[model samples]
Target: MGDHALALGTAWAGSVQAAGFIALPRRELTAALVERAGVLLDAASGTGDPAAAGAVGRWLVEAHFTHPSTLEHTLTVLGPALVRAGPDRGPAVLAALARGYAAALQERTRAEQERITAAAFVARTAAEQARWASEARFGALFADAAIGIAIVTAAGEIVEVNRALCEMFGRPADEVLHRSVDVYIPADDHEHRQTLRAMQAGELEHARLERPYAHAGGETIWTDIVLSLVRAPDGAPRFIVAMIADVTERHRLETSLRHQAEHDPLTGLPNRTLFFERLEAALEAGRHVGVCYLDVDDLKAVNDTLGHDVGDHVLQTLARRLAAEVGPGIGSGARAGAGGSGHLVARMAGDEFVVLVERPADRPDPAEPLRVAQRALDVVRRPVVSGPHRIVVSASVGVVEREDSASGSGELEKAADLMKAADTTLHWAKKDGRNRVARFDAERHRAAVARFELSARMPDALEAGEFVLDYQPLVRLTDQRLVGVEALVRWDPPGGDRIGPDVFIPLAEESGLIVPLGRWVLSEACRQGVRWREEHPDTQLFVSVNLAARQVREPGIVDVVASVLAESGWPAHALQLELTESDLMGTTGEPLDALPALAAMGVRIAIDDFGTGYSNLAYLRTLPVHALKLAGQFVTRPFATGMPDASGEDGHDGVDLEVLALLIELAHTLGLSVTAEVVETAVQLERLRKLGCDTGQGWYFAPPVPPAAVPALFSGPVGPT
Candidate 1:
């Protein structure tokens, strides 16, 4: 096509001779395969890797074979390029292209073979039956079968046999013919003898056994045998017909299936079905079974928020955890029952699980069950999450012994009842606080039933003596000075112990009574703070209370806070609203706009659990933030180990410690001071001091005791080292 075309072709021919092997793929195919072949060739020509330019050429050649039409088109385009290219470059380019095409053709064959095997095996029911029938007849047609075949007498005796049978028994056929079949059987036959006798007496239609048979050599060979009773015209027994097939492989598979079905698929622990079966047997023998019911609190929330796939990961982690606790018989002298093992755990359903323990039957006291329950409770309380969600879900266990089950009805029912009760107790644990485990208490059922009914009567209970507040002091770590008090919501039952916010707060949230309940706390805490300030004006006490995430976004939140300030005549700067990371994350942009308005009014916005949210720095910086309270977890290790918060290349100071430091610095740079929470030791204090931490709070300053203890804490020693 061009004046240099003849010269380019001549140069390319020399390269083919110089390089012993080279491939030529079509131009159109190469163009189709390579997103930018020209750019790839141009860039790779400068690379030191000799394979790079050749590899790309091979990739294009493979595409040509895959799409055959592209091959002709690609070659036509390539000819023009080769004709125009200067002599030296054209030869190298053509040589590389030659080898590439051949490699592609070989790869295509491998991909095809793999596809044939991957296609699903297809067979009709009749076809499968025919194949099995044909397979079964393979050995049956052997005329002179070396193994013995037999027909037993009417009385379950071996009455007839073949020449092979006589040889096997080391006796003449007549001498061995009438021998009793049971003579060669094992002593502890269990029910095998009955099954064989049933077949001989026309009771069992077919009975099979691979039982040991004694030979003339005084050795035993386990035989594969099937028994079938033969009948005369009037239904009288003639003799038993038998067929035998050696099945050592099939027997092994059956045993393996039994093992798998009994154990958990994930943890290899006994499943609920198998556990109950074992417990039933143990109970029948008057065994004292200690049962612990466990539920991983956040498995579902992890599944729902992150994904079910990740939730499965959490379950696996939990299984490993439970295994480590009370595993390997690590505690050599643990309490034991009549049964052999100490503990058995089972995953009953999603996130719900159970643990069964064997307690010493000799003990008059039932403290051993409690000890097991305590151990189980401790194991589950540890924080375990699949991926991003670090949730601590504790379990509640109801441990009841099978004291008097008639020793025959089975432990399964009793153990199951205990499991149900333990599950019931766990509901109360959730009521108490999600991370606390509760042991089953039968004596408290009446009170619990009342509480259950109270769910219906909560609105009325709110009007009654249900909710109140006791203030806890928020003190300055620098000096033993009272800066503010956090008002904790409490619910006092008519004439009993006050229910914690843990129990009733969820109830309030569920019933949508939090709006009223929260409103009441705001007004009450404001009124109380204003009253305390008036009673002791020199004190200048401020009130801080938890504001639910739902309240943060509500249009009425601003008005309520405003009304509280106006009615109580307390300064907004004195009151601080502590909202959790989730609360801030859940808010929309406009609802979040309320933050600026509140900050403008002098109500300080503190992001509680500062390091534990999904907020990016861009959004965090745009916030009307007055203070950033570090979560206890992020700085707790540094606090414990006396380590300065510094960065290293290998990345694990504390999850994102560097990022947090930057966040703190960013807040500082934006004219905001930061507070590090859970600063419990002097080392942590020193670390925080070095980090330029502005405020510190934890038990190190003062524990949250009674409201009356506040004034004493202010005057008394802060804490003992």
Candidate 2:
């Protein structure tokens, strides 16, 4: 067994040496492996645990035998020897050894990947450490290492060249020793010459860079070169010492990794990262640029009906078509200058691509984006044939152009804004109808930006008391007596013009700020109602506040309303919650279920803008509704000026009047009161009263006024003229 182990160990050592980069001596490595193999042979003979053979695998790795073929060689030598030693347990021992080797290799591979990830930042530190270690062992270790070294005088002539350096250039010592150091460097490498001059002049202690050197064999060899200044005993610059390690393989790997990082693997197109890099560079150079952002419509449907493989094929086909049709220089035009004058077609993400056109400052073509967008659309509309399936798809593109004169805070910010504008325009294209191109509209973008600003500031505005409510009185149509006041929210931003609900309400609703804003409105209105009732104990006035769809659907909406009423000392019956007819009719589940619970608490629920929605009388009968606010369209249509009477005289259509009358009668029949909205003229008011409308609220009563102005209207009937 001892002889067999020694023989196997000798073979293992030879195999590892052939694999290259061995850190241990042949004799020492062979002795260690022989002892490990003896233990493995014992394990196979059942004198020791078979798993103990795993340690031999670990020992091989620790000794720096990490070549890919090292394990194969170790296994070949050990497998047969162990089985011959003890046929029964040999297979188990071999399996244990293989698992250990694989685990160690996997761990080492993961660690190497991590090291590569941080290679760029750590390269200088590694070079510095290598220099220090080499200097500490300058005499023997310096000459023996695979690293190339050269000692040069302050005059830039090589005084001595190590044997390793000569071997590195594929030349002998005598030929390289007397040559100037510049002879080994590229002639056009002015930066390296300047750095070496700085070191010789005592301006710098050391410098590190990775550069390529010419080999005698007509090949380029990349090296991590560290140049250090050697000072004399008097502290004057004496000689320069240069140390270089062969990094050709590492450089190749880094270049490949960079390509992988900046490109979409499947499409082989530049990715979002590289696109933004080029876009920012163009903007920084004050170049005129345009971007066409595209999105594949119905991609999800394709992914669902056909497999993801087909979906991927579709994307790949689109990428190839876009690259072919809308590649660099497509829209640069004749005036494009050398600087920033080209185009880049990149895949931004799944089913999305962007084509960037860059032109010199002298050339500004606003229409370039539209042309590129049209071309992109044309290409995407072409049918893609994947195996067994013919897929036809369209893309919506948003186009944005930035002229050289455009002002922005910074290049990165400008690039981001351009992308945002492109994305927004793409949405417009999709919304307008897919398969079309939409150019960025400045006016529309400004409005959208303003809306976004408003939504973003809403929560803070509410918290800061920047929002206030104004009361619009709802009065009886017959006597013009004050019945109730609807609370309308207004944004009274600090040091800014008061903004009406028409502008910010939808913004609030879209952002979900309506829930909290609605809560604030309800609480404030209830408190104001309680105060007004205290001042006039005989009046039975109610306060109506509109509820947004989001608020109505809130899980704890009933609790929120009940808590507000309890905190305000206001009567629930005197508080009417109004919801638009469209919103009320579409509600289901929790929202619909909450209405009855609210009514049970003596809170009145009214459907506002009643005539505008489905107006399903049957559906209306099922809800716990107390009142209906007739939409202004129905009430004002008959009395509206210049409206021709088709079926009647006096500029009023008989059909319009009949519709208004029927709405009022139906509300009464359903045990609900009716309120007419937008009654601006005396004629409209008289007609509403004659039609038996229970109440009316509009500019005719009063525009929405502050809390103090509301009490004056309560003092008099203010009957219609």
lDDT scores in order: 0.60, 0.79
What candidate 2 gets wrong by more than 4 Å, as runs, is: 1-220, 224-245, 265-267, 298-314, 331-341, 349-351, 383-393, 404-413, 423-434, 587-591, 642-650
**lDDT, candidate 1, residue 172?**
81
Best by TM-score: 2
**Number of the top-ranking candidate, with lDDT as the measure:** 2
Error of 2 at 225 (Å): 5.8
Error of 2 at 245 (Å): 4.2
Model 1 misplacement above 4 A:
1-149, 155-180, 194-226, 231-237, 245-254, 280-286, 293-342, 347-354, 359-365, 371-417, 423-439, 443-453, 456-506, 510-550, 553-721
For model 1, residues 414-482, the per-residue Cα lDDT tens digits are 666656556677787777766555765664644565556766667887787577787666655465366
User: Which 10 successive residues of model 1 have the least lDDT summed?
Assistant: 113-122
**Candidate 2 lDDT tens digits, 1-721:** 5787788778877877776767777788778877887788889889888788777666666777655466556666776677677655776677666556555644564454333223312222422432332344455554665567787888888877677788888988888776788787788999998998898889998888779988989999887777778766456787787777665644553455466557777798998989999999988888878899999999999999998999999999999888876774554352223345456899998899999987777867777778888988889999999998899999999988774213543322488888988898899999999999998777687777778888899889999999999999999887888989999999999999999898999898888989889999999999999888889888788999999988988889999999999999999999999988767755542237788899999999999988777667786678899999988899778776734466644466569989889888888998999998988887788778788998989898788889988888887775455
lDDT of 2: 0.79
